[model samples]
Target: MTGAWKKFSAQAGITMSEPVVEQMFGGERDPQRVADERRWFAHEMRASTYWQPDAAVLRAATPRIVVGIGGDSAGQLCDRTSRALAQSLGTEPTTFPGGHTGFVEIPDVFATHLRTVICEG
Candidate 1:
């Protein structure tokens, strides 16, 4: 888990901190819980890697779709993907506060931004 955190921090161009990890996984960080989370993360990673979006369907739904990228996630994988998706849909990504885990890190601010995006959409 520590190694993963370090790798993710480096990739996201963020500093690694124990507090961030604790906040992310909850203070407990129980071995079993961590294992479960890791397994779920692995599954999600694999699923995302292979699941290709249908361009026709995406184009049809483009107007209704809103791509969002975190403010601090520039050059990160999620940021790149969001930008690519928005471009493919002929739109630009909406910038939200904080990094990839903004929703978790700053729920109030993130919620407000999300609401604005949805209302505007």
Candidate 2:
């Protein structure tokens, strides 16, 4: 968890202080709850956990949509993911502020972009 926090802080360009770090790790008072959440996320990432959506139903009910790619994301992962999603949705990916966790790091800017996307669509 410490390593993950450090990586996240670096990726998000957040300056972490000792008190904030302590509060973050120390807030997980319930060990069982944390373990359960971790297990749930692990299970969710498994390929078998996903179901194929029906294309016909998807096309019939799909609304105007845009795929948002994080402008500050490192490497090509976010770009590839956004492109793939956009292709699947038949829409172009729109670049948004910050990285993969952009919404958390830059909530105001992200919210503005999100609103713009919805309004423009």
Candidate 3:
């Protein structure tokens, strides 16, 4: 049986890139398969999002903003933005770990490690 992904994408106006298609399905495939995988990829990445507070808000409120960076996947862009905000606002900077998915995958253990950083500072 055929699904309506192609029809829907065309109707709504969306273009799926090739690599995005491959990553979702786990390997190289024909065009129809690629298109289906693209649909899956869109669903997955959009489902989960990490929320960090606004840097501007942090800077305005805190006397000194201490940015706790949580590795690459931990929202380092936010860390960078926060650090930049801290620098602009004259605050302190800090870092921690679990890489990108560490916190979500291993919250208790990551928390224990993160505590060490906070305690030291």
Candidate 4:
């Protein structure tokens, strides 16, 4: 969890004190919504756990994965679950701007790296 917080701070260029909840959930926090989020987290965790044996996750044989992890609420990548997946893949995890969300915060940087990884890697 601490690592996740640090990751978020580094990627978003903000401190843990920042009130950026809206970045992920759009500031919605109703009871039903919280329950829904919990349910979805469990469901997604189950799904990601299933990928441990996946040929793809296991077959990063020589693949380079540029990780984009948002904050804790960014869903799968933004959680420790993705760290496990990354470890299973045996690749160095690189952080980019944004969390479970895409590179919307800094799309240009993401695009540059994406292109570099595609062409130069």
Weakest 10 consecutive residues of candidate 2 by summed lDDT:
45-54
Candidate lDDT scores, in order, read 0.79, 0.68, 0.55, 0.55
Model 1 scores a TM of 0.74
CA displacement after TM-score superposition, residue 94 of candidate 1 (Å): 0.7
Off by over 4 Å in 2: 1-33, 48-56, 74-78
lDDT of 1 at 5: 62
List model 1 lDDT by residue over 1-121, tens digit each.
6666666567656665777766865555779878876985677756875676775698896468888899988888789878988888888889999898899989999999999999987
lDDT of 3: 0.55
Count of backbone clashes, every candidate in sequence: 0, 0, 1, 3
Global Cα lDDT for candidate 1: 0.79
Candidate 2 lDDT (Cα, 0 to 1):
0.68
Collision pairs in model 3: 73-100
Tens-digit lDDT track of model 3 for 60-97: 77454456555643334455555665576566655556
Per-model TM-score, in order, reads 0.74, 0.61, 0.38, 0.43
- What's the lDDT for residue 121 in model 2? 72
